[model samples]
Target: MAFKSEYLAKVYASVEKRNPGEAEFLQAVKEVLTSLEPVVAARPDLVKAGVIDRIVEPERFIQFRVSWVDDNGNVQVNRGFRAQFNSAIGPYKGGLRLHPSVCASVIKFLGFEQIFKNSLTGLPMGGGKGGSDFDPKGKSDGEIMRFCQSFMTELCKHIGADTDVPAGDIGVGGREIGFMFGQYKRLRNEFTGVLTGKGLTYGGSLARTEATGYGLCYFTSEMLKCMKNESFKGKTVVISGSGNVAIYATQKATELGGKVVALSDSNGYIYDKNGINLDVVKQIKEVERARISEYAKRVPGSEYHEGCRGIWSIKCDIALPCATQNELNGDEAQMLVKNGVIAVAEGANMPSTPEAVEVFQKNGVMFGPAKAANAGGVATSGLEMSQNSIRYSWTFEEVDKKLNDIMVNIFHSSYDASKKFGSEGDLVMGANIAGFLKVADAMLAQGIAY
Candidate 1:
């Protein structure tokens, strides 16, 4: 597709020429740049200042090798990456994912998306992301700790509490964060909020674990109520992924009177026609660290399927893709729209493919882009940073209330922007433009060097 703005076309061409073979990064860049057509047209001074071009490029890219000793005394090696995408708003803040899928392209895509996701939170955070190609599955506690320490030994040099803070993603959790934080403190000889998602015993916020999932439902609920004149009450919801984001989204959706009937992992999906039992799910995924298949084994009347992609085929009123990026594609999206799905909100970063997003847009499925939908975890992380700054903590209810308000405010920001931009109900564009405007304005005020 040809860009309507000549400046955007040139910027994209430069990105493609420079980032050849980086399909994920190129895809993310194209999506956001396309959404900014109206903004570019409305503000030509931004073009003169080169805002679009600069925002597409990272301020710094760091890559390093991490070697650690396994339980067998064999040396294991992995690559680490951190793409500090933008700092127009504040220090870089994002998560460090630990999965075999970690690569330059994946890290760049995530960090680029983080630029907008953090902006939507109305928090003083810029965008950054880091991770390793290390697969943590089936690893022993000692092995995990060794790897984290090795990784953080080098990572500590590039990060500080007020500079760049990274939390957890996919295979990373509190265990990983604790290990890394300990390593950072040892290396830096200082203790601070250099990371979020800390354990309660340390400085982690009360609702940090549940923030992303709960915030997803809160945002989706507002989307349904305002866009479709509907609510989660009596609606059937199918949520993908049984990890942190998926589990809490299920709990909140159920509490809001929605019957969450399905959950999934990379292995497969579980469909409990009798409404999901959140306790059983928490036990299997959280406590046992097992797959969704375990939920079927222990729960009566639940069926376990052998493919994660099949989750989207189930009939439902709402769908939340809390799994990995591009987990839901055009065919799966068609299935949902065909099966009477009324709303689709992302709980994972860029979970829906472009073709899938097109399907939702064409069918008027009340789409909520991941930037706006999944800003909760980071919002709470921002809150965690606040608590850490004051050397204090807020009660669970207080954090929960603040998270709710933030989600609500994010909804209105996206909704109002969509309407103002003459694309009412098109949250993908709304979120992209709303987030970019803040960062772009900041860049402009700070001069072209930014």
Candidate 2:
């Protein structure tokens, strides 16, 4: 949607002009601003206070050099970034991604989305994100440790327990978080919960690993129930990506009586006619860390396709794109709608293109945006932060219960916002508006300090 409000168009134009060659960042900005066309008209004070402009821009964009030595004793250098986008509600809370695709645009877009995602959780977590372009794949433990340490050397200067709390994202996991946390502890000389996805022995919260995926299922189930008067029970599901989010989503979905038929990775996807074996996928992805193709090899009657995009072609009642950004496009969305897909929820940041979302919403498919849907991981991270501050840990069941409650509440919040904003059942606009109002109002109340 083109911006209807002049203020919104101007704000987006400024963002596009300021961040040239940043396709991902621009896309994120446009989506949020487009949703806020109603809000921009409803709250002129927000526009006058420059809240939209401030929200579009980061509070601090930190870029640094990380130099590490490879196993071959060759010095390697990678760029590390931190975009502290907002801190109106609380400290900077987001994840640090470590992938070769980690660039200014990706980090900025992730950070931008984090602002609202953290807000929608109703937790005092402002938005911030950081990462390095150094791919951790195929690297030995020692090599990864060195790279993480080097990355944290500069990052440690800008983060703290109450300042900026970082977690894991794509190409980042417990192992990487462990190395970075260890380095932060050594350098800062104080053991703090500056990072969320930590080792359990140190400060990690139980269920944090499974939080995002479980949370996604919780939200999806709620959306299905509220809008369609249905549940995941007996639904054919197709989930893209076999990483943490995909793995846990499959587990929870199956437990909820949904048959997940397909799972994928960057290289290819696997289709299991009967149902996906979560154990095999976990073994291939989490334990052995091998390609998802291994699942087809080990599990009989499963077919493996050589392209990841083909996973969306599988017929299903529900679709969860847990893969990276824009992995599902407009055409795939059209295909899903044609296949009788009733609901589509995102498990990754901005996984669906704008066109794809239009396709879903127009076709009457229940759409759950990422900030509201995939907030479980960050929501659990917020719980972990609380536990850290008090030096206490909750049981797995306790945390899981809280996670489910949070996800349910987030769904209603988005749903209510959609209804209030006159976009009944349109969670895309609802989530964006619902997430934006809290921060924007807070920014207004704080006396235009941006």
Candidate 3:
């Protein structure tokens, strides 16, 4: 177990007292704080400067109401949120997820994790996140456009190119980003890159769409090589979530000679005895926007399970949880270990619960923390910001090369940090300590105003 210094524990207690019922936010805070005992013990100045106390709190939090009209001539109202958790290093950078589950606690947890994830990228991007409780699944194109415009009407005032820059998350994709970006450009009358994950016709950079998923595989491969003397070649992989992350992860793993056997969505999971058909998945998801069950129906020799969690039961050498937070619990972790799983990497934000992480660590499963493994998206977003600043764009090959190098560096740094802090081979503590030290130093040098 990771140790928590007395000072760190006290600061976390204060956070819990101040923000009751915010389980997601509290969980994120506790995870990061618990891994910082060595830092506090070695450098008393961090506690003296109140870095932990200030870093745990967001610099600014804004909530607003978004009102739009549906196709049925009904006025729809949704709650919107933007939590600028920390800007100690650079401008705020994160994603905006438009789902029914978008609440303050979820947004804050993501924003808080963004702080460390951005730091690990070695990029000048601070942590921030914004989204709404607007479900875009069943909405028409016109309805989604109206809601995005309305959401940006208030969001634009709080964000800018040099300020907080938002990107796409769960429900906010290229289409949604295009809608919001157009609104931002119309209202501000500036063609700056205020939002990332934009279409190529705009200021978007290449390889941004595949960054997160590809990066997960890259980071995971590095961990396997360094820690286990293994690689992805000839390995079997199970990825949850059929979204951008899972799709690209499956693509990269297949390209690397690994057989991805299963993928899941909200409805259920599909297991292909042979390697999954990427073309079929792309057709069903990207082209048709249908469910995973559609893939099972379209492709022969495939079985579709009724529950999404059952995807974890399929035997595999690697498991990537790209679905959602807490999707993998302790029981799932134990089952994977019992089934001879060797590695577990999170493609989503905090997909593994504390108990699940403990199980993996105790059972010798190579665990890649979400903040380190899933950082490729934000790292490319930072590159996109640079391109926007220079009015230049890099080709897909160039951007992908840079992203791969970044992921490799992140893995090495985390490994070295873990070894340095006496938690050798524990990437969770290594990532937390490495990311925390960077932000903490920046905050200390910048003083308390941050």
Instruction: Evaluate all candidate structures by whole-model CA lDDT and list the values in order.
Output: 0.95, 0.94, 0.94
TM-score of structure candidate 3:
0.99
Q: Estimated TM-score per prediction?
A: 0.99, 0.99, 0.99
Ranking by lDDT: 1, 3, 2
Off by over 4 Å in 2: none
What global local distance difference test value does model 3 have?
A: 0.94
Q: Which residue pairs in model 2 clash with each other?
A: none
Cα displacement (angstroms), candidate 3, residue 267, comes to 1.6
Each model's Cα RMSD: 0.7, 0.7, 1.0
| Residue 394 local lDDT, model 2 | 99
Candidate 1 Cα lDDT to native: 0.95
Please provide, for model 2 over 104-158, each residue's C-alpha lDDT reduced to its tens digit, 9 standing for 90 to 100: 9999999999999999999999999989899988999999999999999999999
Q: Model 3 over residues 1-450: C-alpha lDDT tens digits?
A: 334467877898898898899999999999988888788888899989999999999999999999999999999999999999998889999999999999999999999999999999999999999899999998999999999999999999999989999999999999999999999999999999899998998999999999999999999999999999999999999999999999999999998889999999988999998989999999999989999899888889999999899988999999999999999999999999999999999999999999999999999999999999999999999999999999999999999999999999999989999999999999999999999999999999997766
